[model samples]
Target: MKYMYWLLIFIPITLVARFGLQLNDGLVFLFCCFGIVPLAAVLGDSTEQISLYTGPKIGGFLNATMGNVPELLICGFAVQAGMYSLVLASLAGSILGNILLVMGMSIFIGGLKYKFLPFNKNITHNNFTLLGFAAFSIVVPFFFKYSGGGGITEHSLSNFSLALAVIMIVLYLLGLIFSLITHRDIFDDEDEDEDGEKEAPEWSFKKSLSVMIGATVCVAVMSEILVHTVEGAAEQFGLGEAFIGIILIPLLGNVAEHASAIMMAVKGKLNISIEIAVGSSMQIAMFVTPLMVILSALLGNTMEYVYTPMELLGIIISIVIAATVFMDHKVNWLEGAELIAAYIILGGAFLVFGIG
Candidate 1:
């Protein structure tokens, strides 16, 4: 966290690019992208600190809600700008990155020290069940779009998307109740040493609150600036918006969670590592995507849950691979390698095809 402070220099640089020097859109986009990383780190840290004062259940809720703030903010701005494709791509990218890039790296690094690591099978099953539900929700909308029997008007699609969004949100809430209340014990880390005392937070509650607010505001501002420049930047760099959304934006937004997952894995805390990766993906699918649908409508952009065939294919492949790897409750380095390889192949395909 201390080292992340150095990256704060990019904040001023981004501001200068935006208002002072009036740099090119591509350059401003680059600066804002880098600037958002450290702010995200601060946001995570502040959330953790604030959670210390709230108790486990509420704290877990807060952490889950704030985990993807940067991505959410960026997507919100993108929605406002009517970059519907980019928003949807970023949504898919976030889920894929967590399930593949983050989870795979954690398993691979953790496997380097241990030949085989086993986690809670019950939790794994629950996660995959939720993931399956999420996949179904997303797939239905695409089915609606393509199988409408004839031409589908924008109003009809928007209405269908809103209906699905409401259902998804309800399902997500049910999941929260199931996991956090009735089945809480299933997700608990059994390996945690009961006798080990917890350390006190360094920051006071007020300080944590202040930092969270400040970081969130800064992230929002940066995200707006970053999204506004995305089109110009994409054209300037000979890159497609899909490429930036699927690869770059997701990576930038989840950098903090990615680092934490890897660190937990390296420390042999594979349970926490798995939770962070899988849980983040579940959040994106269940909460963020649906919320974005509603938000986009309110913003007058009215994005549907429909996805291009390639994007849908990528998501389905990712879900299937993740389910297979974690189904046995055991993981090895080779399994991790397989996940990373799959992600790379999908990324390459997206890069080449520039899939909407």
Candidate 2:
């Protein structure tokens, strides 16, 4: 009953958004962008519970899928509306959301509780390969655009993008198989059941998977509305579609992610903190964006993955600061504060509407 209350709340929002989209396309997108906050907040709390019982790989996969719930739904709806630019901005926003806004706020809030924490080094190592893939992926859109390739059409960028997506999706499947079956080392979370609040409930593979999917659906539906509402909200604030997405959409999504970071941070789980920040960024960059590309192609929409100069620099700076900070495998409250400051400065600069 209690869980159903959440489902109830979300379902209505989704419906309302659907109606809004029918009425005004701009408003629907606004609503979709706003959907991420509560979803993130809830998932951050629930994920720990699920992660403890189900173990990390499943948890990580769950997190990867659920963490992206908003993006997925918004993209789905956006594709139907032919708002390709909005979709693209949201993609870029998510990476920034995870790296700076989520990570920064998480550290600050978590530092208030505890100064530092420990986390898995091995997790950090594996994440690098994904991050590298993401970094490369981030650059691809730019290369395609200026490479004199008609900005995404000349090289049959769609064909190329689809092929690239095939490779990535294959990689995702291989990674999943490797973790869950072939070599289970990646998912074996030995430290899952920490914080002995309640007796750990046994989760069948079926139950965990079901809840994961259900939660994801709720997130997606809500997020689609969020995107819809964003259009209206942008009008209200007199903002650009890109500004709303690149700035606000990601920040709202960070609500859930920020909580995850803070929790890990307060536990002084710096490695997990960094991983959540960096890993989620990688997922957005490599996994989510590519998946969206493939979906766009199949849906008969042209989805381009180009990044603005601002986006490129943001990714580079975000990775450098984050990696440099986490390299020593330790964190202080001061360091956490520094990260938050950096984000503030960057965000302030980006807010200049005419600067672009």
Candidate 3:
């Protein structure tokens, strides 16, 4: 992790190039891109350090929420920029990347060393149910838009999205209470420190909180610059903004969390790895997506929930595949390969066929 922090030097360089020298948007965009990754990792580590003091239940909630700060800020900035398509595509990409790319890598690499990986069946079941419902909620707007026979007004669609966003957020909060409070016993697994050696926190609570705050602020600055220059950057690369949002931005924002999941899996902690991947995806759908809908309105952009058919299809397929793979709460290398293959094929389709 210390080695990764060396990339932090790019943060200042990004600021200087963008604000001082006024470099090309493409170059500045790339610098901000690299800079945001290390900042996100720092934020994650700090969150982990703080978690050590909070106990598992509250700590788990903190990790789930803070873990997504990078992508949340990025998408928030994009929405503020009125790049609705890019933000929508990014939301879809995030769910796909987490469940498929990150989870697949974790399982595939871990499965090679272990015959079978098993996690908590109860937790997996609840997560998939929540994810499936969230997917269904988001797509309702898409169907509503198309099913209106060209008579649906943009204002009506926006109102309907706003209503659904409110309902999803309400349900998302209830879900937290359900799993973390009312039904926590069902979700909690037995403590497994058989060696009787608990890990210690390296940073003081004050230090962890301070560092998390600073890292988030820096990420926000970088995200703003990244979104500000996205168009120029896309034109320079000859790539559509939708493609960049779907593929590049999601990977860049959450790369740190992705690495953490894969590392946990390699250490034979499939339960933790799956939680990081699947839990984050659920938070994005239930929490972040709706939050963005409200933020878009506040930003005066009025972003709607309606997505392109391909984006909606990709999300639904990703969730379905994830649910199927984890149905039995056990996975092998072949299942991992299948998930990765699914992601690659989906990505290829987006590239070759275009998002719209």
**Candidate ordering by lDDT (highest first):** 1, 3, 2
The C-alpha stretches of model 1 lying farther than 4 A from their native spots are 49-64, 193-200
Question: Of 1 and 2, which scores higher on TM-score?
Answer: 1
lDDT accuracy of residue 249 in candidate 2: 67
Residue 256 of model 3 has an lDDT of 61
lDDT of 1 by residue, 1-356 (tens): 65887989999999999899999999999999889989878877887677668643445456546768998999988888888899899989988898999899989988998899777776677777888998998898788778876788778889889888888889889988997889887677656546354548899999999998999999999999999899899999989888899988998887767776676677666766666778788888988888989998887767888878888888888999999998778999999999999999988988998876
Candidate 1, pairs of clashing residues: none
lDDT of candidates 1 onward, in order:
0.83, 0.64, 0.83
Candidate 2 local lDDT, 38-156, one digit each (tens): 55655555665576675555555555456666666776788777777777777777776777676777667766777564456556655656666667766775676777644455447
What is the TM-score (0 to 1) of candidate 2?
Answer: 0.79
Candidate 3 local accuracy as lDDT? 0.83
User: Which residue runs of candidate 2 sit more than 4 Å off their true CA positions?
Assistant: 1-36, 109-116, 147-155, 175-215, 354-356
Best by TM-score: 3
TM-scores for all predictions: 0.93, 0.79, 0.95
Where is the poorest 10-residue window by lDDT in model 3?
189-198
Worst 10 residues of 1 by lDDT: 55-64
Residue 176 lDDT (model 2): 55
Q: In model 1, how large is the Cα lDDT of residue 291?
A: 90
Better of 1 and 3 by TM-score: 3
C-alpha RMSD values across all candidates: 2.0, 4.3, 1.7
